[model samples]
Target: MNEQAAEIRKARFGALPERVAFEDMVEEKAVLSANHARDAYDPDGLAVRFSCLAADLGL
Candidate 1:
């Protein structure tokens, strides 16, 4: 993944350092509640849920 990112960066920019370094970041967790329902669709619930999450995250 780091190599891929470096390649993309190099494509945007012209050059890269002789020794490129990459650091791994802490993986993010899901902010939404996990749903176990099958064949269930709720657009309004999702909208409200995401709205609350966005507010909580100050987005």
Candidate 2:
């Protein structure tokens, strides 16, 4: 990320978790299929990664 984006992120997230860093990088891959059905994304399989930020952030 660039300096400006880093500043914005720091302001929004306070301090990022150890999993994130100013220079850290991650590789991402996604499968693209029928365009129309993509909008109806499902996440049942990824439930373990779900976070209720509303409660965590006291929002």
Candidate 3:
């Protein structure tokens, strides 16, 4: 019975996985985008420019 069980186990899972301690597994790292700049300036300038453009177009 033991020999039959061993053969069945071997057939089910071809080989045992390489043992890896949990601590040895790769860990996630915090990532942040460095190239992007925050738009901290007020939208007044954009509003003024867009209003002028719209007026010129009679929109």
Candidate 4:
């Protein structure tokens, strides 16, 4: 039974790679946008948004 399962697993997945590159695993993108710089660092704006979200969730 174990041999049959092993054969099925091997057939389905083929062989595993010994190592994977970081570049192969991730697609890099910008974390911050250029246009929203004015509002991005506003603590009051963040606090208001957080409070709204928490209220919406009844938290």
Candidate 5:
């Protein structure tokens, strides 16, 4: 992330959780999708992901 974005993130999240880093969050979601695809998938999981993403983007 750029310096300004990192600063914004720190301010919003109060020193962001390690797992909540932007890149890490994307990776986490990809892993979630892959794992779910390999087994049983919960439709709610994708909905929850979209809700979180929308909220984060202030939509």
Candidate 6:
């Protein structure tokens, strides 16, 4: 590529981001107890939702 094109590209998109450490990159969260009373705790809920979505989208 020409120097003018390279300069224009650099001007449009600045410097690339710095590399992040693996530990810093990942988000760590404590696992909640399965016995918690929440609607999402239902095992078949995901499957039922997915099926409904697929039907609606005609997938």
Query: How accurate locally, in lDDT, is each candidate?
Result: 0.72, 0.70, 0.77, 0.82, 0.67, 0.79
TM-score attained by model 6: 0.46
Query: Per-residue CA lDDT of candidate 3, range 1-59, in tens?
Result: 99999999999988978999988998988886564435555576667556676766888
Write one digit per residue (lDDT tens) for candidate 4, span 1-59: 99999999999999987898988999998886568776568876777667676766888
TM-score of 3: 0.32
Arranged by TM-score with the best first, the candidates are 6, 3, 4, 1, 2, 5
Number of the predicted model whose lDDT against the real structure is largest:
4
Give residue 28's error in model 1 in angstroms: 57
* Model 2, position 43: C-alpha lDDT score: 81
TM-scores vs. true structure, each candidate: 0.25, 0.24, 0.32, 0.32, 0.24, 0.46
Give lDDT tens digits, candidate 6, residues 1-59.
69999999999998999988999988989997685565455757766656676766879
TM-score comparison, 2 vs 3, better candidate: 3
Off by over 4 Å in 3: 22-24, 27-30, 34-36, 43-59
Residue runs of model 1 more than 4 Å from their true location after superposition:
16-59
Number of clashing pairs per prediction, in order? 0, 0, 0, 0, 0, 0
State which candidate has the highest TM-score.
Answer: 6
Q: Over the stretch 1-59, how does candidate 1's per-residue lDDT look in tens digits?
A: 99999889988996755764453435567898666684478876777657676766889
Q: Best to worst by lDDT, what's the order?
A: 4, 6, 3, 1, 2, 5
Q: Given candidate 4, what's the lDDT at residue 54?
A: 75
Please give, for residues 1-59, the per-residue lDDT of candidate 2 as tens digits. 69999899889889645666645575667975667664555786345557787955889
Considering summed lDDT, which 10 consecutive residues are worst modelled in model 1?
Answer: 17-26
